[model samples]
Target: MGTAALVTGASSGIGRATACRLAAHGATVALLARQAEALEQVCREIRSAGGDAFVVCADLVDAVGAEQAVAQVIDRAGRLDMLINCAGAAHLSSFADDAPSQWQCMIDTNLSGTLNVSHAALSYLAAAARSDRGTADLVTVGFTAGRQSGPVTSVYAATKQAITAWSEGLRRELAPSGVRVGLIQPGLVDTPLARRLGAGPGQGLNAAVVADAIVYVVTRPAGVAVAELVVRAVGR
Candidate 1:
């Protein structure tokens, strides 16, 4: 009965936080993640909080996994009003230290996976956009890694850059169709994924911070499209 949202990577970190945030706002959230146990845990928490949630287990890196995840959400929820492309991996190492395969892995998960889910959700999102109730939306999460070249994250940065650029273009392309597309660029969120970066103690924003930003975007009025949100902790 309420607006519906699909959040990938909902097993943990930013995706889990974003799912909870949307559920708190009365949106029925579809959680997509590879870990069934952990993803179900998030769904349980949302249900316990008097919110609606469904879990669809899939590995986004695989060819058909993203589409399968979205299909399950559409089947259960009946429609998709929002999509959060939060599934991603960070391979942090010196450009020279990592093999080409590592970079490919990052590209497949962050870039190709986003495309897969977005393509599958387009029809439902388009239908929602045409509905009078609200504006349909698409959001992809990126990182500050792309904003700069660092000592050991060149490839990761490149991948994030690709996501940012792709999202921006998609936003413009979809803007006329009543579907709002945007990006959430978080700087060092304290997530399981960020832990892979090897940042020392106290070097990140809480996942809740990014989640709050997501809520702010999707909850806006129909005419209000939040183009992008660049959030970072103070002194980071």
Candidate 2:
């Protein structure tokens, strides 16, 4: 009977941390990811801590999988109060050096997956807004790579830039209906995805930092929407 949150990419990194954090604070969490075993483990941890959690194995890159994941959460949870579109892929290759398939994978998973889950959860979130469930919110993870052009992360940055623009537009459009849209842009987090970036001499941050920012945005009192929060390492 607590609030329900649907988190994509909930098996590891920031997604897993966010799921545990939210559930710890009394939200029923739905964990979505392609790795069934990992997702189950997170759900088990949450449940063991006396929190509510459900696991849904999904590849957010696929449209069908994205829709089905959200649908299943709604079917079981009865409603969805928050959606964390945390599903994405990380690639580190120069534009010219990168294969076309690599670029496509980044786009599909980072940009397309965000849209797919948000679109699927729209109705349920809107309904939560209409009722007394509190302000419905959508939070998407972004990166500083997308804000500036980089030598190696060109396409990855592009996908994140798309997310920033799209989320802003969504924030304005949904504000009137009591649904808030938020974006968390973190600079170089020490996640599996971040390691894939091959930071070389630079050290970013741990994924928990990003998870804390998300908790701040979603847990704030109703009527106050934290539209966007950007966190970066001090040396970065």
Worst lDDT 10-window in candidate 2: 194-203
Model 1: lDDT of residue 107: 87
- In angstroms, the error of model 2 at 112 is 0.8
Clashing pairs in 1: none
Candidate 1 per-residue lDDT over residues 1-236, each given as its tens digit = 38899999998999999999899989999999888999889999999999999989888777577788888888898889999989998888888889989889898899888888899889889899998766898998988876777888788888889888888899999988889998988898888877766765556998989999988888888899998899989887
Worst 10 residues of 1 by lDDT: 194-203
Counting only residues 3 or more apart in sequence or on different chains, how many pairs clash (N, Cα, C under 3 Å) in candidate 1? 0
